[model samples]
Target: MERLLRIENVTQKFGGLTALNNVNMHVDKGEIVGIIGPNGSGKTTMFNIITGIYRPTEGQVLYQDEPITGMEPYLISRKGLARTFQNIRLFSRMTAFDNVVIGMHARTKTNMCDIVLHLPRKRREEKECEERAMELLKLVDLYDVRYELASSLSYGHQRRLEIARALATGAEILLLDEPAAGMNEQETDELLQIIRRIKELKKTVILIDHDMKFVMNICERLYVLNYGVLIADGTPEEISKNQDVIDAYLGEDDE
Candidate 1:
């Protein structure tokens, strides 16, 4: 398995409080990996560090074996890393299609001068971006609402829209933060299918979700965290049977 991303002894601190403590993990190319723990266990903090929202205080983050630590978020996105937030972050006033179009900006090659002058290259890029955005909306099953304002969609559709936007960024590796947070069982099942399709499309995904069943169903491996420390890293079956993981997150009676 080729390592696509690696967190090498990464640690984050806020004054005296350590949000992450020398955490070590790696995701292989095209793998679906899950990160689960109780709230404040540093799941989102790790995502922030990986996506360049926060630079780790102690270690390095490598993408495709290249050090990407302390890079700007946009730079990371351009390098094919994109993420969704735990809370839905959408352009509520914009059409879902437009929101996705904005995500493609990172990959667009048209210069500002070309865009300002409405040059041929800008026109061509705009056309291509729109087509790509529509395809992404369709992939997330939001094509019917492509022209609708993001805020008008149901919560589940909004969540899918966020995923679609992330896809539009041409990301090879996607970090999803609580993508299933507010979803019901049916919505979550649908989300699982969408994620499966994303994997089929050959993208690597690292998700932090509280839904145990959802994560277990979709992930190839699981990483359990407790109070900023990694407690277990194994297959779902192993994690389910691991006493430490059960005590920290899944209760003893979970099975």
Candidate 2:
């Protein structure tokens, strides 16, 4: 498999506290990896650092086998790395279509001269962006809600909208934070289908989620973290029966 991302001995600190300690991970092309841990295990912090929300205090982050550490979030996004927040951070006042179109803004090339002159290339570019936004919305089955305000949609729909927006940014690697949060069984099942579709569409996915069943049901590999370091890396079945993992979560060696 082709290498897509790699994290080598990354350490992150916040004032007197250490959030991540000597972490190492990698994601191969076209793979779905699940990250799981107890709260305060640095799961979100790792995502933030990788996506350029925060620079690591030490170590390196490589994307497509090239150094990408400390780069700006927008730059990373433009490089085909996009992320969804643990909390939905949509433009609440904007329509779903508009929200998605905004994600493509960094990639849309239109000069002031072209805008003032109403040049065909500029018009076509904007039109193509809009069409692509719509296509992404359609992919998540949110086309009917295209004109609705994102805040007015149900939780599941909003989550799907976020994914659509990420897709609109032309992400080759998607970092999803708790994709199954606040979802019912049916909604979770739908999300599973959507995730599979995204993989089929050839985007690599790395997600942090608490739902064990959801993670085991879809992810190709699972990484377990506790405190600030990785404790296990294996298939679901291997993780399921691991004594250390059981001890970490249950305070006992036997599961």
Q: Considering every candidate listed, which one attains the maximal lDDT?
A: 1
For residues 1-255, write the lDDT of model 1, one tens digit per residue: 789999999999989989999999999999999999887889999999999999999999999999999899999999999999999999999999999998888888877777788787787888889889888998999999999999999999999999999989999999999999878988998899999999999999999976678889999999988888999999999988999977876452332
In Å, residue 11's CA in model 2 sits off its true spot by: 0.9
Residue 173, candidate 2: how far off, in angstroms?
0.4
TM-scores, in order shown? 0.95, 0.95
Clashes of each: 0, 0
The TM-score measured for candidate 2 stands at 0.95
Instruction: Give the local distance difference test score of model 1.
Output: 0.91
Q: What is the Cα-based lDDT of residue 174 in candidate 1?
A: 90
